[model samples]
Target chain A: MSKVLVADFGTGNLHSVMTAIQVVSSGSEVEASRSARKIRMADRLILPGQGAIGTWMSELQDDNVRQAVNEAVRTKPVLGICLGLQALYEHSEEDGGVEGLKVLAGRVERFSDGLNDCGHRIKIPHMGWSKVHQTCQHPLWSGIPQDTRFYFVHSYFARSDRDSEVAAVADYGLEFTCAAARENLFAVQFHPEKSRRQGLRLLTNFLNWNGEV
Target chain B: MPLAKRIIPCLDVDEGRVVKGVKFVNIRDAGDPVEVARMYDRQGADELAFLDITASSSNRETILHIVEAVANQVFIPLTVGGGVRTVDNIRSLLNVGADKISINTSAVERPEFIEEAAGRFGSQCIVVAVDARRVPDTNPPAWEVYTHGGRKPRGLDAVEWAKRMCDVGAGEILLTSMDRDGTKIGFDLELTRAVSSAVPVPVIASGGVGELSHLADGIEFGWADAVLAASIFHFGEYTIAQAKEHMKGRGIEVCEIIDEFE
Candidate 1:
């Protein structure tokens, strides 16, 4: 059984993700911690976050979490969800534009105003579920069909420097990257824990994944 | 596909058990909240809302426990409503796994509470529940905010109130048409369209969903991003998958996942 450490950088929905990880992995030990020791010792790491980028960044930078997360990103298998995915980028348009974790090459941009789909005004935050299309093959995409809708609640999205890094994309008036992947690092802009069976399937895949692209 | 319109099954909890009060006059025992939530989740329910209508505030801890149980098992966004007054209440619900907190009476009483809650908890988690009743004898028909289950009027315009709620940091508005509520007819399309058009946030049309056609009308004609119903879903009149199927037949985008897990 894998020991999964969900890096809780003082964010919301921490328990939701923790419960999901445990439900998917029968014997896997899932924990929420800010301890660098537990993070480094865990077999897998899941980064879950929400709310503003300013606050999320500040909390992550405290208690040696920033340093610990960086180390885990380089060596251990790590997964990011929602705000966790945005933090991977170099910067974000949220909170009056704040700097991100810089783990990947990208910038987070807010949805442009007055976007219409067939004359219907698209709301901000892009709340609710949307279909995610797999653009590349990865272990995380296993068992999940292409265009499977996942629960997403966000205003800003990631714009990667390279298209090859995008594992999946979802549309909300405009197509945007929903999942990004690299060696030992995979992140999604949707809440898999809040997503149903397919979401649980994705978490199961991640638990069984060895972080090999 | 764009973001699929959400279909939420609202369950009213009273005294730690699930019950549905049709128009707040006839209360019927539905089932356990956790079990019902699981049934909906397996049936591809987009989301679930637990309205704690437990009159006695002493049993407040009951809904929290129920939400915690469901959140631990069910893998979908859960919204808890009915009697959310303070930031502490919002924090407690969110901490117990409520993806969103729906505010109705408190939001109408103190608009500043929405601002404070949204500021402290982020706008994405705050959902202001607006109960709108159409004023009688109006040329084009205007609606006003009514609290206490449409028994009292807050003297505020429904459309303008929705706009104000969004302006004060509410991420979404759960607009219920008091005039159409419990009527088998349909949603107040005029009221829904007016409010949805006025606000930049997503609006959930609620309070009068009788059949599958009403669900479609709420999304297609009313311009609501989501449709919430209780009676049709709680009493076994319709399942979520069936509702999605009916909505999809009408060209509305709805989400359904095929489980590939062994």
Candidate 2:
């Protein structure tokens, strides 16, 4: 009967994600709040964002949302999407290096070069649907197939300090990590709300995940 | 990375309600803006832009009330524009919970409005909306800019106006092709590309979308940051979920679509 809290940072596809959650996890309540102060009471949390890494982190610093996120992740199932995923890192290359929340032990860096050693031909912001190669065991993939397509629109991606944090990898010019999970924390570069069936399945899985063996 | 395709659903509101039309005329009444917004919210729409087509002429209070209702009900970022002529109007829209405020007629009539709004609200909050119609010239055909819901023509060239809007303050540009507006034949790829490449800020392509493939083609060939459509979505011709699925099948990167019925 407890409701799930979706963090609304005044930016991103918060509503789309919340609606998906509501449908996938029917009968459960969903609430959205811009203030991080309201996030602590939720049974779980969804962080959805749309903006540059630098600007999003800047606003978080201005609002002191970092601490609220850190505390929530400690005892709750937290999912980060797009800019929300980038916010989990220690820093980002956006705007010549802005510090992230450091909830995950890594940094968000821009793609260095291109696939096949080709010149910097690919666009910097990786926007669109890409195939995700699952690597870790997370209940969020209950009915989903391996290497299913998910939506993504981001320039920078997460680089975990530990190898185990990566939950899935997506292919672009070369294979890269698209989704990551460390403990109760989970994040994806692609957006689930914008992603169709696979995205809904993922949301359904997240809702059904009981955090128990 | 190829430019990501954006699936944008635009709401045309009259008297604080949603209405649709062809070529920006012969308006047809749709459902409540807030209710429609909630529907799109569930269907995995990438973004929502609320065009206050009648707010400039009357019922400013009703417009804000509609915006507040939709914003409170939906979770995605909302961009509100129509009859916005001053920085005060821009600020008020943002204050009323708009993620961004779009300006068209004002920016063309008084170019300084863009700069002043940008100065006060930052480029992120200010968006310049341009309506362009292809007109024949003695030498080569060109798209002439129109204002006040395509009723008046601005002497300035659209390409030049785009650059000027960026120079003044617009953080983004919403370019709608009047020729394409209800046709759904496809987007004006030339117009979208011209304006997107000209402005440094993000460009959202509006008008002339008949199918899902058109959205893909516009983003890929037109270089649009986002693609906006009205009739296709308003009349249930296409669902956001289906559009996203088809876009994904076409190898375009789109947001994960949450199915409405699922």
Pick the TM-score winner. Answer: 1
Indicate the residue-level lDDT of B246 in model 1.
98
What TM-score does model 2 achieve against the real structure?
0.69
DockQ of 1: 0.71
Give the CAPRI class of candidate 1.
Answer: medium
Question: Each candidate's chain A: what TM-score?
Answer: 0.96, 0.90
State how far residue B156 of model 1 sits from its true place (Å): 0.7
* Top candidate, metric lDDT: 1
Query: Given the true complex, what DockQ would model 2 score?
Result: 0.13
- Error at A100, model 1, angstroms: 0.7
Error of 2 at A8 (Å): 6.3
Question: For the second chain of model 1, what is the TM-score against the true structure's chain B?
Answer: 0.94
List pairs with backbone clashes in candidate 1: none
Tell me the tens digit of each residue's lDDT in model 1 across A21-113: 878788888888888888888988998988777888887766577788888888888999999899999999988989888988999999886
Query: For each of the candidates, what fraction of the native contacts does it recover?
Result: 0.77, 0.08
lDDT of 1 by residue, B1-262 (tens): 3689999989888888787632321233236777788777777888898888863579879989999999988889998998889999988888888889999899988999999998887888999999999899987889999987678999999988898899999999999998898896999999999998889898999988889999999988999999999898777778888999999999998886564532
